[model samples]
Target: MKEKRYIMMVGAVDDQLSQVRASLTETMNQKNVITQWILSRDGIDAIGKVDNQKFDAMIIDAEAPRVLNADFLNGIGRHRNTNDCNIFVMSTQDQEQLHPNLQKYAFLQKPLQTEILLQGLSEALSQNLKPSMVEKFSVDVRVINALIKATMMVCQNYGLDQVDMEKPTPKLLELPWQGQSGAYLDIRSQVFSGGLILSFEKNVFLKIVSEMLGEPFTEIKPEISDAIGEISNIILGNAKSEFTSYGVEMTLPKILSLGQTIDQPAGSVSMLITFGTPMGKFFLEIIAHPRK
Candidate 1:
């Protein structure tokens, strides 16, 4: 028998719903997943109808002021049909304050990137068929930027001197050890183990250390390596709170390592962000996978 298709609807304002519908339609076409969709202005009415119908997934555009309210989200969470269906929220506002009861739902941000949204949808839909331990998710650009900024602030607080800070560019480099290196952070979640691996150039590492230690250029040391690992741990801590609010659990502490090269795993996505500081050029490579 052919696989059962899914349904995705927009429960938000007219303009916001229109945008989501267009983006979702294009994404579904590419995946070739048959899906039914609709836009509903009233949350109560929408949930009432959805409760009686069947769908594989639902995309809720929380950007709409009327529908973004707590009561509305709560209503959707209470719906019976929603239990087995994948729920995705699209919003421009900070999702940290979303109703606690709605925390388990997935979310996408406004001005959505096609690839990112598609990847999120694919992962959510494939969740059931795949082994629970094999399921995974990625960090949104907004969250990633927040984590990077927090790391920089932590470095400053520790008296590290700042260097050249510039936007990250997407490019591949031939590393002496790892061969071709892609310019992006590939984040993932592991069922058994949880931690993050950050990849960056030696120069970037030196600059970050100098700023954090409030010292001038010097040779890398065990102390500096320890400090870098602690810094990564802090970033992960801050990022985890945001993830937890969305019903994603993260383990305590982050591990850091310094090496000439890193090996990229198969079936992973990459996000590239560049930073230029007065101290020097630094690139942050985030490779997150299951600990086990």
Candidate 2:
């Protein structure tokens, strides 16, 4: 059941809340949500609002006074409807300053873009969301998480400067991407079949490949496509043993050109796994069918 979401914005500092409002309003209509906003000039005031009412989501700015402590977080979530209430922490500082527990929640770079803000919100929503997906996908959440672990492993091997990922989200509509250069590998086992796709924006791809291959690439070249395939191979290869335990195996990667659309097989579900890097964001899409 889709319910009204009370979203509290703390330390807005300016007219930014309007930007968030506009963005959420645009997307909320598609998801059938009614978002109510609450404002606080500081964390102390925000604490009052949080304690008195139930909030599904709370966005806190780094500049919010007296909010960096664990006590604030400990207080804010108890009154939330779900134990997994969406909490976004925004900071201008490059290094993290929030409590260790708070660090796991969404952390946004300040001077934030409303578009990226919406993306962070969507990603956090996807993480905390749990309804009908397990039954519909017929796959355990552990399998999905293991895929994330495998992807992170590959990302680390490639020597990505920063490797932070949004938790996986299930996609119900057409998969939209800003960049078209990507690759996919077919995965199969006694219980699972489908494919895994690694995709990135053009600049992100160029930067990652350049760093991986020790060359400077300003634009797309045929070699870059091959590099994508090779990188994807390493990823699944690393996961092979782990997936073998789950009875999952993968085929060699197939490259996707600009604007190419992957054909989702019949009776399959796809999970969009987004990873944040110093360069930009890339995704690992698992389109899998868990057979009976």
Candidate 3:
């Protein structure tokens, strides 16, 4: 997969926030970069999201109700994973009056214009950007394509407006998959076999379930588990013909709880792929092994 860029937009709920988001989305979509926009409604939430997840760039409103602290800015620059992450400040104040550290970043005037916002973002991304190059698993491209298509179709069926899929990153068989929000299924075939895991963050899982069921759900109940399994089944069912071309078949899906781990076989190869949505992010793990 091509390198994906994650951006954080920080400001209060207002027209300006909506405008900035639209501008950012257009700029990123044009580049075909699978970008994730983590909307932070206030400085405090922005700080928390930046600390927890990695971001490629951050656009902050200086006049926000909860003013961003200098320490927060410093922290973003200091974090090991995000040291290269670019910061762009939006304000009407003079840049000269701001802290010397903050002055180093790009600045945009208020009432954000699409042309200017795009220019600033393009420049920020061009600096010291490194492409992600990971080894590929031995799975056939057809299988990968089918799964990717299934994922997108499922989300669209549930009313999601945008779905961004990143390139698949290879992984060793032994390393346990991260996160507990997922459903598991077994892949069977006369020639090869493995397990498939569809994982999501807590909020994303709930949102998907709500959409699939046509109702709102705040908790992960037993029925929610069944819904996720059914969705997984649908994806597999959608991709059944593609896998059949390779002489493979998928079994019924089972709910994987938050703490359970997969026991992979020796010498097996796998790839981890992630997708971003307005609600949150989700990932897929495909582990494949040749049957002896």
Candidate 4:
């Protein structure tokens, strides 16, 4: 069920990204993943694409429309950070030419070898570790990273400056969560299918919604009741780019009103992740019904 992934190539030669695409296509089938390739004319065009769309990953040429600089590379890296998209740089020059400020990406030498490129891509995923407990708990780290990054970005974008993630705990369908209002998106893919919920306390939810809508609210008004659902949609949408590798699909999120509660989602497995917010804490619960 893997979805086609989009890749952006900045300042690349015509054949550069295509060959990488071919190599990826050949290798991914063995792993049940598929990717779609997009070539950027140069740095300028690449910037536009990078800003407007969600690319699973990016490859940049040292030429960078001739050559790259610290400022430009850092700029792109900052933008890509929200979604944790990997960046690979292609260069025929010395490593010194790369920006020291940018360390989160991979540097590939020219005379590109498909094996090296693939290896770099693989290692990039492993480069950063997830929250210690979640890392050890989840069987798949990629999905965990994708979802966590999306959660942090969404909250931060909504004005939560320092969101802290907590370890995931096993969830029981029969148990209730501690949040006042919440929403969850039901996800389905080759690996698992279940509801992914983000629950928040009454104050945190209201404050977040207030920041979101530029209005203050002490209760869930008709105008603000859908805020949780919208937040859930954004989280899944951002993660969907990475989920493409899993061929994942999701349904519109359902809201958990302040008074309403559920024991668990319709899946057999559930893992709960917590994020600390200014007003209080919000929870991210991943409930999965693993498919054989």
Which candidate should be chosen as best, given lDDT against the real structure? 3
For each candidate, give its TM-score against the true structure: 0.59, 0.53, 0.49, 0.51
lDDT for model 2? 0.65
Model 1 residue runs over 4 Å out of place are 1-4, 11-32, 68-71, 101-104, 109-113, 128-196, 199-211, 214-226, 240-259, 264-292
Report the C-alpha lDDT of model 1 over 192-233, residue by residue, as the tens digit: 112233433555556556765678655656556555555566
Number of clashes in model 2? 0
Cα lDDT over the full model 4: 0.64
Error of 1 at 99 (Å): 4.0
On the 0 to 100 scale, the lDDT of residue 221 in model 4 is: 74
Selected candidate, larger TM-score, 1 vs 2: 1
- Model 3, global lDDT: 0.67
Model 3 lDDT-worst window of ten: 131-140
Compared with the true structure, model 4 gives a TM-score of: 0.51
Quote the positional error of residue 215 for candidate 3 in Å. Answer: 1.1
Give one digit per residue, the lDDT tens place, for model 4 in 151-247: 8788888778888765557767667765988876676655445667788887788877888888778997787788888888778888786788767
What's the CA error at residue 96 for candidate 3, in Å? 55
Better of 1 and 4 by lDDT: 4
